[model samples]
Target: MDPDRPLIPAELNRYARPDVLIEKGRLRFLELNISTRLGGDAVARWLADAYIGLCPESGLRRPPSTVAARCEALNRMRHAGNGHGGTGRLLIPIHSVIDVSGARQRRDRIQPVIVAGAQRLGFEVFQADLADLSLDAAGRLLVSDVPLDVVLLRWYGSDRIIDDGGGLAALCAADRAGTVGLFPRPESALVSSKAVLSWLREDCDAGVLGPADRALVRDHIPWTVCLGLDGDPEVERNLLRMAAAERDQLVAKPAVGQSSNEVIFGNQMSAQYWQSAVADAARESPLVLQRRVESGRITMPFRDRESGQRVTTRVPFVLSLFMVDRAAAGVLARHMTPDLPDGDVVIGMRHGARPNAVLLAPAS
Candidate 1:
């Protein structure tokens, strides 16, 4: 560990990290069945087993092959609208973070959210990191190569992600111009960004709170600081004012940052000292100073632990809403430790969620 890096604790240690928590029960496990190290298919197997386990609901485990067969059936849905020359495929490239630097490098440590989600959704989702996405070419992601449907613009941390507007906008353009039907960016960008969240609240400001919104924001979001992980100067100055005026309990985050990494607040921050760091963070993109919430998430289509049946249940809580475009897609109710500033990223993988537990936008 570098001496100059922010002081890290055992949990924060990138080397060891929060236990991978692979297999908790006879059925619950994370590591792909080593017996089949087949390409992307290994990941596909996990989803199949997960879903098959859901189908039984009698606490019976599933054979790995059963899950793979179910997952392969997802190809058509992945290309629904675009299959008939609608749009080639939504191209959600991830090249912006290649050379950018600021937040702690935890990309390797971060779990593969997109890959897993794709697996569960049963799509053979293609992946391209910063370098693969960087090459400027028309065929960067050729339409003929694979069956593509929606483009999932993904990233690990908030530091570099919020500022990737160019990349996202490009994706948006590709979806509209090409053969893709959707381009939903990462949850961190669509929900966590203060700027975007503020906009959504204002738009959905129908003069009253939905029953779910009221339940979620009970007691003004029970959070202390606004963690701004952006680097734009303008965004930084605004953060200083928010800390000075509106939001006193605030944190300074790099524009390109990871959650809880570089988060400085309370006694650690000086109204003046943070302004410089806030200014540094602002250069990248607009950072936000927001009231925190005890957030948690439960992915839909979860399987029951005891029965191995498809039933939704709550897992790790990371407060982030799920969406496709501006319309509300699905709101996650994640459970976090009561006393921590952070939460787990991938908490559960179960069958579709219950109707009322979440707020989902209408089908697109």
Candidate 2:
């Protein structure tokens, strides 16, 4: 993908799944993960199976299957606007370089789960590194001489594509010529920035959002401001003032980041450190200062790994809603046990959080 190329109009409208935290009985969106390289689909399936086995008589509805929903999403994308009606070959390109953070190892573990699920649905699938993909003379994406209809991106970061000598150019050429489709679209890289969320809140504050849009923003989106040398002067001034008086209620996040890496919680910092950190981040690149939403706590049972004894404890949890083709597909819940040393400020796999099933209760 060319960094200077303007995105097509259709690319601007694509949506991604939202990672949400429940606070005060409302869903507060932490980030819009606009890429298809999302985690937890396989974990969701495993958790659902374990949950159903443990609560056979509970009468709660089984959670929708993320694997099935994602496979269906791929089928739809393969056929959408391409005029190819039959089953199409899908490829999951692995990155050539693996970072020390273990992201590649995690993706490698889950790729087979998705491939198996897609195979059961009668679609042909292939997995290979980005270097394995090449464009044929006709500009079609191919691996081992087999043409591919869609590329399911499971790798992290678009910068990897740019780092490849010719892979980025080939993919862009194939995508532009309509010989292949890229799920989630490359424009997702642009939309996934945390700055976009700040922009949404800023637009609402500026009265640019319509009545319904304003209500939606007010209800779900947290108060966020992009902090940088080029940022809105009024917004930056107000954010700094609030940070001074109520640092405990704020968090600073990189405008483009994954996991909890480099996330700074205001409450955990001294007043001097907080001020210096904010100033340093603004000088380097645009970062977002958002009102932090604390995760809701729930009591759930867990079996002790060493003793095999079931124990119940309170834990902090976050709910992630998966949206496929603009429709709600399923929900995934991740929680951290009370014993973790990180306390409740951050919760993720890196922080010892575990995936839990979300079972829907029967309506009265």
Candidate 3:
């Protein structure tokens, strides 16, 4: 993709799944995952259902299902494009060779739920390894002899698409030739990168954004800067100095990572270790350093395994909000308990955080 060319405004409207932490009674966005590969929706639906079943008098409604919303979004995109009319086939291309950390295992567990949801939505859904895709005479993507109308990318690392050779070529050709609709177009991953936050901050500083956009950045986005020295040297030097001096107020994250993998809290690291980590991360890949917002704690009920009784405990939690086609879909909340060994400043399922159902209160 051309760095100079701006993304089409329509493509930017696909999805915005932002992970947020509540600090001082305000929601602060930690990072944005703009692709269709957002997981935990199935689990969230299950939890919401179970909660409603156990407490029918709560007077709260279950949050909308992300899977159902995603299926509907895909169907709309297909119809808007050149999709085959009745019961078009949707193929979820899995990457067998490249796995992003524990993505393959999570995808394996989540795929069945997604497929079941898609099937219920009236689409003949199928999953296949990327290597299994083929192109017909019209550049249409096919799995075995069946042509596809839509492709859902379940894989995490978009950069690895180039490594798949023919599968990548055929898929790209099909998408570009309008033979098949690709949800959350591949370029959507670029908008998801943590580096984009840095760019937004830069744009705001340069007065490139309008008043409303600038206010949105100032109100929601934390102070963020890319770790590497790819841009202005003086700005890079100032960032380096600030990182070294304000270690307690910052966090370092990989620009294109998920599940809080390799996220380092500056307060948790010694000055020497923090410097070394920043240097190492800068050398490896694009990294972002952002001002840390301490996550607020909430009291929730949980069963005590050893005592065989229910108890309430305070835990740090993050709320993930999903917006499809610029409309609010639902929210999924995950909290980390103090007793968990893997509990840290970062909250994610991979780090032992447990999903909590978020229900909407009845209107007054």
Q: Rank the candidates by lDDT, best first.
A: 3, 2, 1
Runs in model 3 deviating more than 4 A are 1-6, 35-40, 83-87, 100-113, 158-165, 341-344
Each prediction's TM-score versus the true structure? 0.38, 0.86, 0.87
Summarize candidate 1's per-residue lDDT along 1-364 as a digit string, tens digits: 1123333232121111011121222111111111111112334335445655566644443222322332232333354555344233333344444324554443332235434544675455565443333212432233334434555433434335444434444444444444443322222232333343343343345536776775443323332222344334575456466666533445444323332445544335565776666655655555544442222334445555567777654444332232221222222232332222333232322222111222222345
Alpha carbon deviation, residue 109, candidate 3 (Å): 5.2
- Model 2, which residues run further than 4 Å from truth? 2-15, 35-39, 81-87, 98-110, 156-165, 232-238, 302-311, 341-344
Highest lDDT, which number? 3
Error of model 2, residue 316, in angstroms: 1.3
lDDT of each: 0.37, 0.74, 0.77
**Model 1 ranges off by over 4 Å:** 1-79, 83-99, 102-174, 182-188, 197-249, 252-256, 269-285, 291-364
Between 2 and 3, whose lDDT is larger?
A: 3
Q: How do the residues 1-364 of candidate 2 rate in per-residue lDDT, one tens digit apiece? A: 5455678765543446688988878989988876453434666767777877888887776566556677877777766745344448888776544454534332344456678877876779888666667888888887888888888765436333323546656777887777887766766667678888888997999999999999999999999878883866887778777787788888998888777667898989899899888878777887888888887788888888878889998788887787656667678788997567645466777878887778887777
Looking at model 3, report the run of 10 residues with the lowest lDDT sum.
101-110
Between candidates 1 and 2, the one scoring higher on TM-score is: 2
Residue 172 lDDT (model 2): 77
Tell me model 1's lDDT, rounded to 2 decimals.
0.37
